[model samples]
Target: MTTKMREEIDEIPAAAARLLDTQTDLIRDCANALKKADPKTVVTIARGSSDHAAYFLKYAVELQLGLPVASLGPSLASIYEAPLKLGHAAAFAVSQSGASPDIVAMARGARAGGATTISLVNTIASPLAETADFAVDIMAGPEIAVAATKSFVNSIVAGLAIIAAWSEDKALVQAVDALPEHLQSALALDWSALLEPLREAESLYMLGRGPALAIAAEAALKCKETCELHAEAYSSAEVLHGPVSIVGRDFPVVAFAARDRAEASVAQTISKLAAGNAACFITSDKATGGEKLPFIATGHPITDALALIVPYYGFIESLSRARGFNPDKPVALKKVTETQ
Candidate 1:
């Protein structure tokens, strides 16, 4: 029997296509609202896999819109009962279920604080969606896996669509238009290159820079959830600052390098880690010592990073089975975390 995680992973490409095709009206409406607001800063609210999606958008917004994006802690509203002055900002809250209390709380707080808030959620009827000024149903369908696969991809894709529309950037719009085909191609990639080193390993490090850092973080979380391995994600620069000391012959590092401005620097860092005899592999051809993993170039920086995760999802799901665990039902984890 195929695991739910594997089935969901395989559905990722179709899930992305569904969002792009069916959610166009919602995407355009939200984008038009953002364009009208013309906010100076963008704030994001999310947790876990959703938070990682926010991180990916942070870089894209900064790079494309020339505006900074910050991730606001949900505790300010949910736990501390504090408020923010977001009159001149925009807030994007991403959630698969859209039912988390803290996510809904922060989103409501952002709206009350005067931010033009929007939600990219799988569940359109959920609380987070109701609280936002505009809600985009990401159209990932019902994901049965405890570990998020399709929803994560759709969240990022939905955000990218909004960004393209808001900025009116022809290049980005083209990139967004081309993602379904690129994502389909990404599904076939075999990242089994990570298997031998990661199979028996108890711990690992995932490295990336810029938007790819978000992919690295998501990959690290998936490793922990599915394979029960301890994994840490760090920027290419930050790891050398201290984390590199802990890396030895037994350590496995997977560097995620996209076809973006930061690719060479990330590849360079991977090469340095490999020189220390760490079992290092990278997703770029620029790295010298590290083994190169295959990556699909989506002809855009942001999509290049996002596309790397599909093969990774497949790899981790298979790794879970190999290690005698069910990826669909990772121990002690629920599909929706209703944190307050």
Candidate 2:
């Protein structure tokens, strides 16, 4: 039987297309507002999968716009009641449900701190949207899977669109427009080679650099939430510093490498780990001894990083089924986590 997770994974390309088609005006409007604010810093507020999307956008904003971005802990506003000094800053908040009290509180705090607040949420009617100065509804549409698939992808896409518009990067704008086609191709990628090792493994490490590090984190989370596998995500550079101590024989390591500046370093790390007898797999073909998993290149760094997750979502869903767990109803998880 096909799972809800698989169905939502298949919907990703269409969902991305629909988001671009429907939210272009909102994205442009938010970009115009951001341009006028000319904030020197960008602050992001989120948690869980939404936070991973924030990590992805942090790199894009810093790289393209040359403005440093930081993620603000929701507890700062929710628990500590601390005030942020963000007068010369902008905030991007992402929540699928938009009902989390902490998330909503932080967005309000950002706005009160004089940041131009923008929210990307699936539920436009929720409090987080109302708290922000601008809200772009990421039309992911009725995600039934407890583990977010399309919404997570669209959240990143929506943020990228706004950044594209703000920076007026013609190439990134074209790349964003062309992502549906790349996403369609991404679904066909077969990562079945990873199944045998991951299914039997007790724990694994997922590594990436730059924006792809966020994808690695999302992939690692799905493995635990869906398959009950123990996984941790780390940057390709940081993995060798401390985490590489666990890289003994047959230890599984999945390294995500996009066609960007960090690719060579990631490949080098994967190769070194593979040489140490770790069951290392990498997305790029440039690595030595590491198994090559197929990936689609979107010709832009940000989109290329986003595309890596499509096949990974597919892989983890099947891995979940193979491990005799329901990917849709992960034990202890609900579709909408109303965290305060």
Candidate 3:
């Protein structure tokens, strides 16, 4: 019985606190750099769950600062993506460890093109941070288990700081800043309602669109690593594209409804699924003006966005115990996945 093998959940709350505590300066500097940045557009380079964070950041940065945001997928970052045209804009390569050579190269390319490159990572001195004009450390610390328990939550926190820094919005910062405390409270909520279906199910799909899709994708990734469950994530539209075919009564689609224009479309999809008798668990804030889906409410939009990730810590961790799998030590998965 290894200590690393058993103590993932117990360590997360403390690790998250450390990540937040150490990030004050990083947040301030990233915010300061973004303050005077007359950026034309924004681009993010990331992979796996980090890719989804880029999607969420794109929406938040665009909504708060009104800048166009795009994802430079790992595949495209090295080869396919064209020369980014935003000469004076901002580009961020978000990685948990700042590994991912391709994103490093992409950030370097953006720097070569005279764009301001920023790296967001958990480690202070990672390769991804080496080339950026600025770097925001997530400070989730050590993350001894490979599935990225605390780093994911902290990266979202760091992203919120970037949002506050760029928009100079104190109200939003306070809301997000207060979340670690609220998250401790959120942890006390009876999560059985959320975890039961997953415990019994052979398969589950966590779905969301627009900004919240990234949260769902990350939730799915966590479920896979911790519980060894067959879980996946896709855009609400992308799910409707093909995943709808496999949808009968047993398959559940956990959908996220955001406050933006994408909300209407996502709500409509949930309605269609309900009409067909598919199991749908929907979570959102009041910003949706009350969708017809069975609701799990959250706080304000930005806080709500951050809170969407709160439920799964217990959900997967509990499920791992029920199924006798060690959620912390996922087979063959390492903390830093290195590749060219």
Off by over 4 Å in 1: none
Judge candidate 2 at residue 36 and give its lDDT.
96
| Per-model lDDT | 0.93, 0.94, 0.70
Give the residue spans of candidate 2 off by over 4 A: none
Error of 2 at 93 (Å): 0.5
In the range 234-328, model 1's lDDT, one tens digit per residue, is 99999999999999989999999999999999999988988889999999999888899998999988889999999899899989988889999
lDDT of 1: 0.93
The reply for model 3, stretches above 4 Å from the true place, is 1-20, 75-86, 194-196, 257-268, 284-298
Q: Check candidate 3 and list the clashing pairs.
A: none
Candidate structures ordered by lDDT, highest first? 2, 1, 3
Between prediction 1 and prediction 3, the one with superior lDDT is: 1
lDDT of 3 by residue, 1-340 (tens): 5445235544555655675677788777777776777888888888766776776788778878888887765555476755656586788888888877887878877887777788878777888888888888777667676666566667777787778867888777776667677666555544555566667677877777766887788888877777778888888788888888887677777776655566667777777876777777666432232223332334456556556565556556677767777766778576677655
Model 2 scores what on Cα lDDT? Answer: 0.94
Pairs of colliding residues, candidate 2: none
Q: List the RMSD of every prediction in angstroms.
A: 0.7, 0.7, 3.7
Evaluate model 2: give its TM-score: 0.99
Estimate TM-scores for all models. Answer: 0.99, 0.99, 0.84
